[model samples]
Target: MPRMTTERTKTTVRIDPSTASGEREALEQWLDFHRVTLAQKCEGLDDTQLRTPSAPPSDLNLLGLVRHMAEVERGWFRRVLAGEDAPWIYSTQEDFDRDIHAADVDTYEEAYATWQGEIARARTLAADRHLDDLGLGEHRTGERFNLRWIYLHMIEEYARHNGHADLIRERIDGATGD
Candidate 1:
């Protein structure tokens, strides 16, 4: 397949319309907002601008967060939901907090692509199941969790990272989160 030449945009999200009612809408909205917010942090930047670390000790950068998040999306949707048993691109069942490695632009692209693909897949999964349906999976512990856990977890993850990206983008080029 030909590689998509079009870059990501804050307004280009591909969320499907909801058939079920209730908190699914809020959860979906949060997910949608964070997706755009995440991309906003990445706006108007070249490779060099993206790679530069945000502040003093934190190694988190816009591109690196994208890389890390992409890995997370893949892990949850492809490996967990689909039960592929594939090793995680970020961490093969290890601590996901350490998945912030983006060595170069190519690495960022790969990671981001991984995330985008998985996001699409996860949305498909969500579309088929109502929010009440059990989404069986495990935490880092041996304990199992349901689909609700996954939805909440992903939203938390994205929101936290979007906060990080807010400061990083501002420092990078006087940009602010919307």
Candidate 2:
């Protein structure tokens, strides 16, 4: 006989994708859901707690995640999509992981603010563009991706990092939820 076990389902207060009426709307809603989920995971935590790493030899933390996402948002929407000459906000050529490994409690407010700002900018950049619209910039492989591809990629990126955020938040204060 096979062993039986109970599976747990976590509760979340994210946007409902089913309510979205179109392809673009659904993508936006899902991305927003992940973005909010990341923010919610970092809520109620002190600066020090937010900066604490998941474990030894691992620099992953909530604060770093916010900074990293801000960089990502800027890279995809501002630079790639808009073809703007925007520079890195947190990372540098010498330290690419500066956004991740250099998490600082003192810059908590600035980091979150930057992330929110990037999100707003991304929305504005994509608002008037169609899904099939190609980006003004090309990927490192010399290929350009469409706005639809960027949206899907961003959603995947946030989803993956949000999983990390869930683990880090749980380890930080025993908080757990989806």
Candidate 3:
């Protein structure tokens, strides 16, 4: 599952081939829904509250999750899928979990800005490609994939992270559901 930051938000899941503006529209709706759910976990909190570690040995907070998900979004859509350079947002690739480590974020506004920027780029890529279009770049193992695979993989990531946020929110302040 994709790692989640915090917060839940409104979303509709109905995908009508006729109403789906396009494949990108359907995929982006689910992606946006996941982002909104992550935002819901962080609502009504300050930087200190947002950055507080939720459990022992895990400095995971809603803020960190936002950052991490931003990284994930960029990695899959921009870097891996879209063929762009990674911003190296995290300190270490050896530990992907580091992408979500709780920290003293300067402000909630700034974190959201970072996430929004990445999501926008992802949207652009999804818009420009067809469901059957495999990115020009191949994986390290020389394997290639079509846009259809990317959407499925992303859905898996979001579902996993949303589950994580559910547990973390309950641990932080008994917040859960919707």
After superposition on all C-alphas, the RMSD of every candidate to the true structure, in Å, is 5.0, 9.0, 5.6
Whose lDDT is greatest here?
2
Residue-level lDDT tens digits of model 2 in 40-113: 88777767777889888898999899999999999999988888888999888889989986533336667889
For each candidate, what TM-score against the reference?
Answer: 0.78, 0.88, 0.77
Question: C-alpha displacement of 149 in model 1, angstroms?
Answer: 2.1
Q: Order candidates by TM-score, high to low.
A: 2, 1, 3
lDDT of 3 by residue, 109-164 (tens): 66678888888888888787888888766655778777888787877787787787
- The true-versus-predicted C-alpha distance at residue 84 of model 2, in Å, is 0.6
Model 1 lowest lDDT segment of ten: 1-10
Each model's backbone clash number: 1, 0, 12
lDDT of 2: 0.85
Error of 3 at 29 (Å): 2.2
Which regions of candidate 3 are displaced past 4 Å? 1-25, 93-96, 105-107, 140-142
Report the Cα lDDT for residue 101, model 3.
Answer: 61
lDDT of each: 0.68, 0.85, 0.70
User: Per-residue lDDT tens digits of candidate 1, residues 1-178?
Assistant: 1132344445445454365747877787778768767866776666666766888687877777887887777666555554556566665345555466454435456656776776787788678766655544544565544566677888899989888888888887787745
For candidate 3, the lDDT comes to: 0.70
Better candidate number, 2 or 3, judged by TM-score: 2
Q: Report residue 138 deviation for candidate 3 (angstroms).
A: 3.5
